[model samples]
Each structure stands twice: as C-alpha cells, then as structure tokens.
Target: MGLLVGLVLTVIGFFLSVLAFVLWIWMLIDCLKNEPSVGNDKIIWALVIIFLNGIGALIYYLVRRPERIKQTGQ
Candidate 1:
C-alpha cells in the first residue's frame, strides 16, 4: 500500500512540475511579445519571469496584462 501511494505522489509531483514549466514558458513568450502600457519595460518583465519563475508569470498575468477590445465594422 505504501509503495503504491509513493508512486502516485511521485507522478502527481512530476505532473505539477511540467505544468509549471509550461506556464512559465507561455508567460515568458507572452510578456516578450506584448508591450506594457503602464508598468516597467519589456526587459524588466522578461527578467522577472525568468528569475521569479511561476510566481512572476502569475504576477504578470494578474497585474500587467492589458484588456482586450472587440472591433465592429459598419
């Protein structure tokens, strides 16, 4: 029973790590591509994402990302 529990925990840990890595990469790319409207420069945001890891990406998404608009044609 203990062995099976250990294996399951290990698999869960591995999956979480992979998810974090993907989120980090996606946020890094998005940060690089978008220009910040109010906060620091692009280089700074990029560095934050690189150094602070997943937390930095979460911060960027919550604090810095711009609002989207819908365009209408007449």
Candidate 2:
C-alpha cells in the first residue's frame, strides 16, 4: 500500500512539472506572437520567461508586461 501511494505521488509530481513546462511554453509563444515591436521590453521579458523559467515568468508578469515598452523612434 505504501509503495503504491508513493508511486501515485511521484506520478502526480511528474504531471505537475509537465504542466508547468507547458504553461511556460504557452506564455512564451503567446508573447512572441504579439506584434509588440522589436526591441520592446516585453519581448525581452518573454524571452527571459522562455529561457529562464519560473522567476522570469513572474518578472514578466509583475514587472515588464504592465509597463508596455515603446519602440525607440529610430
């Protein structure tokens, strides 16, 4: 019984990790698809989220996305 319970918990943990990865990928793709301009801060944040994982996603949401960056009038 204990062994079965341990296996079940391990499976659940694996699924949760996979879910988090999927969510991160989804967020990265969504951010990339947005026509938010090249060199925009949000894009950087998105890339950070994509490559850096959890902390980057948190920063993207809490710090970057809220303050939209404008293209430098080059």
Candidate 3:
C-alpha cells in the first residue's frame, strides 16, 4: 500500500513540474511578443519571468496582460 501511494505522489509531482515549466515558457514568449506600448518594458517582464519562475508568470498574467479588444471591420 505504501509503495502504491508513493508512486502516485511521484506521478503527481511530475505532472505539476511539467505544468509549471509550460507556464513559464508560455509567459516568457508572451512577454517577448508584447508590444512596447503594452507595459513598462518587455525586457524587464521577460527577466522577471525567467528569474522568479512560476510566481512571476502568475504576476505578469494578472497585472500586465493587455485587455482583449474585439474588432469589427469598420
């Protein structure tokens, strides 16, 4: 029973790690792609995401991401 529990925990940990990694990469790319006008500085945000890891990505998503605009052909 103990062995089975350990294996399950390990698998869960692996998936969480992968999710964090993917989030980090996605945020890094998004930061780079953002226009200069979107926020203070793209380079700074990129560095923050790189250094702070998942937490930084969460912060950027919550604070810096631009609002979506719907465009209808004028």
Whole-model lDDT per candidate: 0.77, 0.67, 0.77
Give every collision pair in model 3: none
Which is the leading candidate under TM-score? 3
lDDT of 1 by residue, 1-74 (tens): 99999999999999999998998998898877755544667788889989999999888777766431111110
- Per-residue lDDT value at 59 in model 1: 85
Query: TM-scores, in order shown?
Result: 0.78, 0.64, 0.79
Candidate 2 deviates by what RMSD?
5.1
lDDT of 2 at 10: 100
All-Cα superposition RMSD per candidate: 4.6, 5.1, 4.0
Candidate 2 regions exceeding 4 Å error are 58-74
lDDT of 1: 0.77
Model 3: weakest 10-residue lDDT segment is 65-74
TM-score of 3: 0.79
